[model samples]
Target: MSHPVILFEGVGKKFRRSLKADLLYGFQDASRSLFRRKPLEHLRSDEFWALRDISFTAGAGECIGIIGPNGAGKSTLLKLVNGDYRPDRGRIAMRGRIKSLIRLGTGLQPMLTGRENIYIQCAQLGLDKRATDATLDEIVAFAGLEKTLDAPVRHYSDGMYARLEFSIATCLPTDILLVDEVLAVGDIAFQIRCLERLDSLKCNGTTVLFVSHSEMTIRHVADHCLLLFDGEALAFGETDKVFLKYYQSIGYLDRQLKPLGTSPEIPADFAGVASIRALAVKGQENAGGVKVFTGQPVDFEVSYFASVPVDSAGLVLQFWNQADILIATTHSDTDGHRLSLKPDGGRLRLALPFLSLIPGIYRVAGGFVSAGDWLGYGGHLLTLVVAQKQGQAYEGLISIEAKVSNAE
Candidate 1:
């Protein structure tokens, strides 16, 4: 069998906290090398490991997502892979040519025009004048910077600069690509274009290392994922399992249900009006939360207590992803379904024929509204774990049923 495109064996990288310590260590290491003495293998007093014992491999046409919180060495790992930094320990092997979309405008000269900078970047990528000329129009069109092509890069906005940089970097394909959160730079349309470009490159057998905090984006692109925490590889494997571990690590899955009306979104007038006592999924044994496969039936039974009689109270269920982004909302009033709750309390069941949510963890919050006035709100009342159906793959926040057929 052919070799993997990229491989890492017990890789580690360290850095000093202060410039003084860095300079001192650099001098010491230089002297050790000159004298042929053994270099230090452990962390010094003022130094710490930015990454440690990171071992993984990427075969051709695979995209490995690197995810973690801030200061988790996600960027550091990409820099190492891009040859911008040398590891203090272990080994990294890479085959064929490499290209990176890490720090988009790093090599750009402020005094140079956008048109001139394109040629410079092409040269840096080892493209000759003829080759650069041939692809120049394509790059300019991709960037959508035709009007500003002759303007100095210093006059360009941050978004314009990023567009130019991304266009130039991705104009050509390479064997391995390292992407580090650069997709979030431009506008939404540009970001979509970038993702399409990445997909095209991957289809052409490019091994990719994609680093992003957006789990949805990671899920959409990566076949495997590497999660880092405090410079250590916490978990590395399939995207679903790794994300589950990530949620568990951050206490997202273990979060206890808070009392109704305790959420900050609950209005002051909503106090003592009505509160959701419990939210459970029908037919689920686990009272803690709900777990179901994509396209599976889901029934959310929300038990609530009302202090006063409400003739027409509507129930609203909001679904938010792990990033606290609201993905979907189902309100009873939207479908002409309103509740007639007694003074004491009652149970409200919101049944769904099919749950079309993509595979991931979601926070389910319930609220009551009557006559356009907020009754009460409950935040994080329940957790919804949507898993992929057996032998099925879906992307984005929701899945839609469709039939495929060939044109006659």
Candidate 2:
């Protein structure tokens, strides 16, 4: 791809669990080097591979998103690229100048005023007085810290520190950028500005390596993605494909729905009146669970038993996201549809011509009510996993159809 701006071949990094082992290994490695002995290639006791055999390439103007669970070596990879840590094995090649927003207040002097720290950081980034002076106002404005620009950085809050750091780092143009979840500290408005700044950088032919846990953000910004699991590269390719693989690797297919809360028991007065037996995706059944893609036709079948005929009954289906927040719900009577259960039990199917849910895990629940009183409630009866539709650009918890047109 036109001479990659960054390349990593078989890169591996290790760390000792304790200070004692670190010192011991440091001395042993130094001794081996002094005696012209080969360096240790295998891990020793109390040592573990933080990253192993990671290889990827990034060309100019491309943003590669690194994602996985915590301790997946995402930050480690960014540090290696930023030269904060050197790989013990393999090689990392880079072209052009690089800037890192890897940590909050990383290069700032806490004892110095924000105004002074700005100059110092700019100098470190290879900007002279005239250059830093030209962009100083812009940076201050972007950080929204003009009133407190003369205050010591130690007095600043986490959000203030993040805003200032991000503004300074991205104020000047560079060939490569490394961001590691630092934008999360800023407010949503600032985060949006940072995304715009990243877009501008990409337009200037900058190669970016971004690490974050928010899949929606990653999907919005990244051209490609790298998935890490337990210090290894599980998948790396197109963002959508990698995300799908990531969900699968994390047991999303086999993940069980957690109970929303204490499920309401059948009231003594209404015992055996009606009960929800099962809730499942009509046509998508597998050993792991139910899975479907975005925009695909879906049918949810709710199985129930009615001990006695119920003249008036209402059925409700709920969809909850991973955070247990209710996203969407449906009721049989909402559209003037009556749900009358006969003495015999049967299954009711709710059909959707096109599912509008975005790709993620969701919990399906069913409830039965008669005349505004709940007869039975079943929560988290089924775990529904929605996958990204190939070549679809929609994101967030749900997808909606919209069109953009020019104003008359």
Candidate 3:
């Protein structure tokens, strides 16, 4: 058997608490905190253990995904491997030259142009200027920033910066790579290219440590899996089984989505906004919410928070067949309010009066926006079962409620 490329043994990280310690004292006591021995001392109480005793291993050519809910320490775990932070206790072992996409432009020079930054970055990674020059065009072309490569990086857009940084960081033939959800940086073509590159690299002997909340990407790319929760290892093993367990725990499938062995998944929930943490479909347990029936007054609710308030927020919830086509979008909220929601943390709540959805495990998808940016995402919120028998007629989608007489 081959040796593991990355091994995490009892890895853990602790962060000093933030300034909320003095909150214990009432608002009136805020004045006393100014003279306190150490203002940061107050922050000590907010101390959080970001990652707990985590243990895992990945061999050459293997990609392992780290997943969990927000604040689950998924990011911290990757940072630990990337050498961003020192674990208060425990050790991590690596087998190859590790390239971390933890930060964009790790060695970027503020006053440098994108061209200079690229060369400097290459040199720092141990490449000669000649080697840097050779690969420079490929990087620029891949980033689709040929026009801006000579311009100052200060003028680069966030996506452009991501592309440049990613192209630079990944250009080296490192034996191992640590990646975040950096694929969200470029357009779809670039994204596909990057994924293909990762696959190509993996086939050649590089190990990948991927961090994402995307279960599908993980299931698609990882050979082994690690589930993190509250900064601790919750599960780790073969990707298929472990990810399946994760899906079940997250309510993706209940004992196999009822109808038979198909795990529920949300491929594109927010098709327009900046994306969301996650989403699910549920109803009152006692209300027989187990499986939804067609023509039933079922409820569809999408919940998501923004990293920053976008200008607009909306969704295109499309129910797809197994082949994946837009059967229909049951709801649309484009009243001009979703794009300009006030308050950064505001969420949109949309309710459909009567659900005229056809059953057969229809997948739901739509766009969500806050202040006007779209989150390119997808997936199934829930698999509803439309009852074959027409129980009680609803006064909506099926038809408007206006009586018709023979005379009419």
In model 3, what is the error at residue 78, expressed in angstroms? Answer: 1.5
In candidate 2, what are the lDDT values of residues 216-282, reduced to their tens digit?
A: 7898889999877656665678988788767654545324433543233323323347867887777
Error of 2 at 172 (Å): 1.2
What TM-score quantifies how close candidate 3 is to the native fold? 0.55
TM-score, every prediction: 0.62, 0.63, 0.55
The residue-level lDDT of candidate 1 at 267 comes to: 34
Number of backbone collisions per candidate, in order?
0, 0, 47
Model 3 ranges with Cα > 4 A deviation? 19-46, 105-107, 254-408
The model with the greater TM-score, 2 or 3, is: 2
Q: Model 3, residue 1: displacement in angstroms?
A: 5.2
Which candidate comes out best when scored by TM-score? 2
Give a tens-digit lDDT track for model 3, residues 1-408: 268888777775666554454355334245555555322212134455566567777888888887777877877887878777776567788876888886665556757899989988898899998998899999888888888878888887767877888788777668889888776666778776777777878888889988876665777778877765455454577676556545433444443333553333444344333554344454432111124444445555555555555555566566654344344564345554444434344455556555554323344555553333345565655443232222232221123324577984
- Per-model RMSD to reference: 14.4, 13.3, 18.6
Sorted on TM-score, highest at the top, how do the candidates line up? 2, 1, 3
Q: Model 1 over residues 199-317: C-alpha lDDT tens digits?
A: 88899898999999888789989999987766766567789977876775454653442333222343332445887887888866333235576787788788899999988888888
